[model samples]
Each structure stands twice: as structure tokens, then as C-alpha cells.
Target: MRGVSADGDAGLGIDLLDAIEALKSVGCAVQAVITDGVATSIREDRRARGLPRAEWVRGIASQIALARRESPNRGGRHLGFAQALVHEMPHTLAMLRTGRLNEWRATLLVRETACLSAADRGIVDRRLCSDPAILDGVGDRGLIARAKALAVELDAAAVVARHRKAVSERRVTTRPAPDSMAYLSVLMPVEQAVCLQATLGRDADSLIATGDSCGRTRNQLMVDLLFDRGTGASVASGVPVAVNLVLSDETLLAGGHEAAQLQGLGPIPAAIARQLVADAVDNDTETSLQRVYSCPQSGALTAMESQARTFPKSLRQLIDLRDRTCRTPWCDAPIRHHDHIRLRRESGATTADNGSGLCEACNYAKEAPGWTARPVHNPGRTHLIDVRTPTG
Candidate 1:
């Protein structure tokens, strides 16, 4: 029979689907063969020639990266899977070669059996991978459950030891995000995580019941309280943690639904912004306001000017508010410097039009070889800048 056409023509729908599935099966078989070859080469080279593991892996990854146009991490993952299939899980390799098991499924077997010794892993591979029909209706979650049960049954002590080791490595990490926001990640015991979540929920409910007109949502209140407690800010003592907000007079006074920009954070309900302002003003908390004008069409700000020419503190604050985060494309790092898009020595004006925010890494990356940056003033878009790299 003639194969399906490249475009959506010249075959029945079922036939086209069958052809696609056949191609995918062939591709999996091909992958298994290639991986086996690579694994064999690595083993032979490492044993007979005595290459170090690190150097050999780097060499393999470099070759794979150049050939496949993939990152070294991806190459390393492929090699890892290859090594597992060749040495630890021959039955898995057979299933993969016969197109009965996909890469993800085989990888799952490898990952779930990681706590097992090589001999135990081989036992598991033999049991599960011997017959494809046994897993006919099993999904990823089901497979994981079945595999985990088998592993724990096989080596209960090993599972307990692995769990105890993982508990010792628990930690909290912070990652920056767009709009002056950051993510706080906690890797802890399951019970501890649940307790932390429940605590946040209880405090949020209590705060919401207090009945301020602030219109802060439950999630918002939880976040605020977490920050408040973490930073040791006292709401009762009138030393609440600072939250910056930008609001217009019309939205604040007239109760308009126009969203307000929370500094470093993105947009929030105008009502919430108004309530924050009212609470701060009523409590006599330290607050500052600036009048910012915007271009009507693009909604970008007009230049904020200063006569001192060294870039005043007010100007720095203005740039921070305008850009919110690093101006480099795809970079969400918090703004660390108020920089001239066109270099100061290159006759760039010390106005908002020429100023942008950049994090330390990106700001210095601009000074690297073959990098150029400058502001491009479109009539409607006043706060536009362009950055170029060596490649471009």
C-alpha cells in the first residue's frame, strides 16, 4: 500500500493514523538500537582504555549535542537511560526494541527502582518487562504504584533508608519571578508541608473575618500574612511589612474597576489598591506618591526628568516602578541598577526615556564582547529600548 501523503490528503483517516503509529513504533525501535550501541561503546572504551567517568561523559555529551542540536543535559539523560537499559535492565531494552514499552515507561522503571541494588533492579526488570500484556491498561500513576509496591516488598529496608536520607536534604529555596515577585519553595517531609499549608489557611480565614473594606482575597491575605510573619512585621504595633502599590486618583476615589499595579508585583484589583492606600494613610505609615504621565496610545510613560543629571533617587524609584524588573528579554531578575540604555559616554540623556532597570548579571553581560544596547524612541511607545547580542 502507498504511504500517507505529507499534507492532509490521499489516505483514509484510519490508514493515516495507522501509518503514524507504525512510524512511532519504528522510531522507538531505532532509539533502542542506537542507545544499545552507544552504551556498548562507552563500556568498552571505559573498561579497555581506562577513561575517567566524568571526561568520558563530557566527551559523549559534546558529540551528542553537536550532532543532535540538543543541550548536554538532554544528551546526558539519554546516555543515562542507555546505560540503565544495557547493564541493569536488559528485559526493559528488549521491550523497548520490540516497541512494547516507550521511553517514558522504561525511564519510570529505572527511576522507581533507583533505591534497589543492581541485582534487585535486574529482578524487577525481568518481572515487569517480560510480558507487555500485563501492563495493557496501566497508566503512569498505576504503573508507579505497582512498581513502588514491588520495590518496597522486595527491599523494605532500602525504601526506609532512602526516605530517611531524603528527609535530611529538605530545604527552602527562593527564585525570582517577573514583576518584582519571587517564588519560595519548600522541600520537606509530607506531614510538615501539610501542616504549613493548613496554618496559612487558618490565618487567612481569621484575617478575612476581621472585615476590612480592603477586598483582599483569601490567597492574597495568606501571602501577606506569610510575608508578615516571616519578616517579623507587627500589624498591631503599626510596623506592618511594606507593600508598594501604584493607583490613579479616579480609580481610588470613584471605585473604578481599573486594575492597579503593585510595585514589583504585577496588577491587582483597584479596590484592593485603594484599601491598602486608605489603611496606610489612616495608620500614618510612611508613604510617598509620584505623578506619572503616560502615552495614550501605547500606555508607556513619558520621560521623568531631573536637573541634577546624576540620576536622583526619585528618578531611580521612577524607573523601578516603570520597568518593575530587569528589562532584558525573558529575564525576570529583580532590578538591581538604574542603567542608561545608551551608554552615558555615548551622549545618552539622563531621562526616563534613556533609563531602564537591569539585574547585575544582565547589566554586566551588556559590557561583554559584541553586545550593543540603545533606546529606540517610537513616537507612541516612549519607554522602548533594544538590546543586541553577538549572534544578532
Candidate 2:
């Protein structure tokens, strides 16, 4: 049986390699389709009226997103990569077609050389990827480092411009994780990020040296210090800002085991929610409770109304709580707009049933021609919306 197992394992390894080669072939075909589709869209737009070529190209990404089952933003990136590979980085694309390079490594090459002009990019691509042997043992980071060095040699000014542009785009974001935890990410310039980490490490070491570190590990101490410094709360568990905790009366009052939601985050254990409330009370933190009326059986938020066209702040908060994030399909961006599912001018009321939470981009996209959205009714579900894109 052991000998048979070894033979089976060898066959499985061969099959896995074949599968990878097939995936590489599919990736090449997908890129070809994307570039050809862009050309076709531009030619068709030239024959049409009113719509600019750029606007027509915008819709192409959405259509590609639908076909690929991806977000519109990711579809746009895919289109950009396809255009670069087909028009500028032919050597890298050819290597991808030959299965010498995978999609991710090819994307790294394209990204690292993005600051270079087309001619310079072509030069880098030819030097790095012209022969399969050039990348035989190189890993992702090694490939990126080599590509960056070539790009700097070809045009250092463009690299400087790219760094400046990237610095301007620094931001902080959060996402939920498993085990009732969440990740907070800061996207800053490399120097700033490195400095921040070093500062945290230094502080954590000093705390450990003081011999009152409370048995926490170095990484844990760094995290706690980060929280305390960011919030100025002295203690990591102290609440320095408003935190909206949504829990049912049964869960809060009785010993019900239902999950509760923390706004901007996702579901947490009911026990943890009660613990947070208890801690707030014990610490004498100023807290306020607002009643959020919901159907007892279905847990859907009760409808709130306004006579005005625009949503009021309270109603907007309700919509935000109800939706938790953008209502667009597959787009979980934090809600930035309280939208009327049906246009207000088209007889849509300013009420909870008619309102939805959408990110800024999704809200603007919905306003474009041929895009439509409406409320969906499901007896036991929370707020639901049906959105139809132009392609649909």
C-alpha cells in the first residue's frame, strides 16, 4: 500500500502541474479578450453620438466585472493591466502565455514598472522577462526589486513622481476578521510606516523593561500601546469615542445567547456586548441609549419617515445601521451616502423603506443612465435592495 501511495502521489503532482498550466493559458486568453473588447467598445463609440469614448469605456469595466464575477474596481484594474501588457509590455505577456510566469508575478512586473514611460517599460520588460531562464528561480520580491531597479535606471524622475502620488493617497481602513476580531490598516509612505512600527517597538520594549508589563507579549504590548496612544485613553479598554452597540432587549436584559452587532464592525457574542456595557458603567463613561424599534419576530427595523426630499441625520444613521455597509452587490465599502432606492423626483418617499446606504462611487454610478434600484420585500429578512446595472 505504501508503494501504491507513492505512485499515486507522483501522478497527483503531474496532474497539479497540468492544472497550473491550464490556468496560465486561461489567464492569457482572458487578457486577450479584455484588450479586444476595449478596442471594439472604442470603435463602436466612435460611430455613436452624445457619449464620449471615455464614458463608453467606463461601462466596459462594469460589464467585464459582471462577466468575471468581480467588483467594478477590480475589473477596472484588470482592464488597465490588460492594456499595459498588450500595448506596452509584450515580453512579459509572452512569458505569461508560455506558462513561465504566473498571473500574480506578471502583475508585479507591470506594477513595479508602471511609473516608466511605454518605451522605458518595454525596455524593463524585455530585460527582465525576455527569456524564461531570467525568472527561473526568482521569487515575487526578487522580481519586484529587479524591476524597480530597472525602472529607476530608465527614468528616476518618474519613480519620484509615483512616490509623491502614492504619499498623497495615504489612508486608514478597517475590515472584520475571524474570531470576533478586526484588522485596522494604515496605508502611508514607507518611511512613515517604518517609523511608526519602530516607535511602537521601542515603547513596548521600555514597558517590558519596567517589569510591570502584565504578562503580555511584546506584540500584544505594542498593539495596546497603539490603541492607547491613538485614543488618548490611558487604558486600551477605555472608550474614548462613541461606539454604537446594537443588541436585542432580550440579549441585554435576559440571558439570551443571541449575537449583537458593533457598528462599523460585524457581529460579536452577546456576552461580549454585555461586558462592554458593564465596563462603561463601571468606569463612569458617559453613555446614551437610543431605542431602535424593530419587528419582534423578524428583527427588521421599523420604518421611519420624513416629509422632506433629503434624508435627515437621524434617518441616515438608521439607514447606516440597517445596511451596515454599501447595499451594492459584492461591494462592501463603508456607506457614505443615504440614497433613495427610487429617485425622489420619481415619487420615492423619504422613508426607511425607500432609503439605502451606498458608498460614494456606487451612489454616483446608480445615477448614471440605465441603472436602477428598488426595495426588495422578504418577510423575515432585514433591508434588501435589488440593483440592476446597465448591462442587465
Candidate 3:
């Protein structure tokens, strides 16, 4: 054969794209049929028994199993996934039909919008996929980011409420893995998880740097510390690992209902947090309390800097207590550095208002080409740092 002709290869690729588009259209049509069938069966069953319309899709597990040939639980995800596209996100559904969006992309739209109201989701679908050509080459990451950004921009309040509900449902679980390993999952609020990881890393780093040598790598050391604590044994390094909690004075002193935030974790119930604070004060000689004042409307906290004006451990603690995590939006990494939102060379003050907590990665990323961050002043709202990316 002559060397594969580039023109012929390009033609074949175009033909494959056409075939995939046809498959996507067929998939959407088939899903429509399956959904209608499920609805028809549910309606007919309800009519025979005089059940209400609201209850029609409630007890659908058996019918779903019989029709879909899968577990009802899995079937339900598909059913709801399909229904959402058909009803709320017709623009996205149209993209699926036109082969501009694949099955997974369409599914992603449904998933990320699960927290949104039907009307808001429809708005997002119309905004993002109204013109199917716009989604031609957008990967999953871009699609998700676009969807989430739109959702938050349109209705930050709703997103906040959804997050609060999710936080309430956080839990921990475990499962077996390959090679006699196990996976331990702690599904808690973002801040809590960040704090735990940061604490472990801090202890591990300290041990690695000590005059006494530990041959184990940082990763290995972290695991050892985790296991030692889990098994009720002291960490071998003998350096105290402290986790700070930022509690409101009202909650700490008067036993109010306001939940205190654990330094690395999110909110803890007022009563239990108070008890922990009391225990710490009584037990730990090194425990020092920092008074934090927060604005009533926005809950943004501010604390006074040290008398020496030094960015010491105390100053780091203050920023951590104030920001609670990295100041970068959507990046919840624990605060590893106190950074100036305005660069020092540009006359950025070193005061609390001009300072923010940022993880090391984000801190470094801010210095990368075309990235800029500066604090904004909003009269009624808390101070915000506006970050502009290279793309922006």
C-alpha cells in the first residue's frame, strides 16, 4: 500500500465523527422512549388504583428493574438524569441530539445542576449550550467549570444553601482495596479535611527536618503518624501537633447556638465545641486565646496584629483564624502562607485587612505569568480578593 494518505485519513476521521454524532442522536431518542414508557406504566398503574399524580413515580423501583434490566437505584439515576435533560435543560438535550455533546457531557450538566432549582438549571443550559457549536471541543473539566461558574454567578445564595445541606450530611466510611489494602474516607466539610491534612503534613515535615534522622520519606512519615494516633500511641517525634479552633466569644462563653468553627474543619455544634475549648484551656499550658471580631452581616473576621509588627507564628495564627482556609475561591487548601493581596512592592500594607491566608501552591500560582489578585471593597459585603486568571 502507498503510505497512508493524509487526505484519506482526514476523510475517515470526519466519517467517524459523523457516526458518533448519529449514535448520540440515537441514544437521546432511545432514552426518551424508555422514559415515556416508564411514565406511561406509572400512570396506568396509578389510574387502576386511583393513586395521586405525585405518587406515580415514587414506588417505581420494581417497574424500573423490570424495564431497564438493572438495579432500581442505578436505574433511578438514569431516569432522573434523563428527565432533567428533557424538562429543564432542553438546550443541552438538543446538543446531545445533534452530537455536539456526548452522553457524559450531558450527564455532567445534569449532575452539576442537581443542586440548582429547575428554573436556574434551565437558565444555565440556555446560557452554556444554546448554541451547540460552542460545546464542540470543550472537555469535561471546562464544561464542569463553566457550569459551576454560571450556577454560582447566577445564584450564589442557592449554591451556599446547597453547600450547607451537603455539609450536614457529611460522614466517614471505609472499604477494602487491592493487595490487602484499605481505603478510609472522611467526607466532612472542606475546611475540616484541609486542617487534618495540613496538621499531618506539618508534623511530618518537622520530623523529617529534625537533627535526629528518620529514614522514612514524608509520605511514609505521614502514614506512620496517622496510624500511631489511630492506634492511641504517641507520635514518635514527640513534637506536639496542635489543631486550632476558632470559636465565637458568644458561643465559647455564653453557650449560644452559634457553631464554632474548628481551625481545619468547618462548624462544630456550640455545646461540644465549648466543652473542647474548656478542656483545652484547662489541660494545655501552651493554648493561647486570640480575640476575633467579625462583622455582623457578613461574618468576616478581623484581628489586631502583634505589637512588634512581626509576621511570626502568632500573626500566622491570626490569619488562619480569620480566613479559615486559603483565600482563593474554590481552593480550600489549608493556609500555609500569609500573602499580601496587593504586592508589597506596589504599596500593599501588611495590615490584617490587606493580608490573606493561602496554601503554598496557590501562593506560588499567584506569582505565575498573567495571574493577578487584588482586594476589592464592597460597602455591605466582606472584603474580597478578585483573582484574574491568564485566560481572563
- Give me the runs in candidate 2 sitting further than 4 Å from their true place: 1-7, 21-25, 35-43, 52-54, 378-380
lDDT of 3 by residue, 1-392 (tens): 25533475888878776786778676865675468566566657766887666555553432343255553345556778778877788888877776677778888888888888899999999998999777778889999999999999888988899899999999865544553245678899989989999999999899888844268888888888887877565444222446577777888777689877766666667887776656656655356676767778888775445433335676677778878877765556667789888787777777666788987756765664446778786645676888775435
- Clash list (residue pairs), candidate 2: none
Positional deviation of residue 300's Cα in model 2 after best superposition, in angstroms: 2.2
**After superposition, which runs of candidate 1 have C-alpha atoms over 4 Å from their true positions?**
1-22, 25-29, 32-36, 39-70, 173-184, 230-392
The candidate maximizing lDDT is 2
How do the residues 1-392 of candidate 2 rate in per-residue lDDT, one tens digit apiece? Answer: 13433355888878776777757766764676566676466547644857654555545555555566766676667777788888898888887787778888888988998888999999998998888898899988899899989988999999999999999999999999988899999999888899999999998999899986899899999999888888878663469688899998888999789999898888999999998888988888877889999876778888899999999999998987888887766667789999999899899999999999887767776765567788887766677788787667
Per residue, candidate 1 scores C-alpha lDDT tens digits across 1-392 of: 38545465546666777656656655755665676586467556655766554434334532343245454345556667767777799888777766677778878888888899889888888888778887777899988888899899899999999899999999876665664456898899999999988999888888778885168898887777777787686453344556667767688889898788877667877877787787788888777676887777876766787655568997897888889888866556678888888888888789888899987756665664446888887888657777765435
- Candidate 2 vs candidate 3, lDDT winner: 2
Candidate 3, superposed: residue stretches over 4 Å from native: 1-25, 52-55, 59-71, 211-214, 230-392
Per lDDT, what order, best first? 2, 1, 3
The full ranking of all candidates by TM-score, starting with the best, is 2, 1, 3
- Residue 122's C-alpha lDDT in candidate 1? 89
The lDDT values for all models are: 0.73, 0.81, 0.72
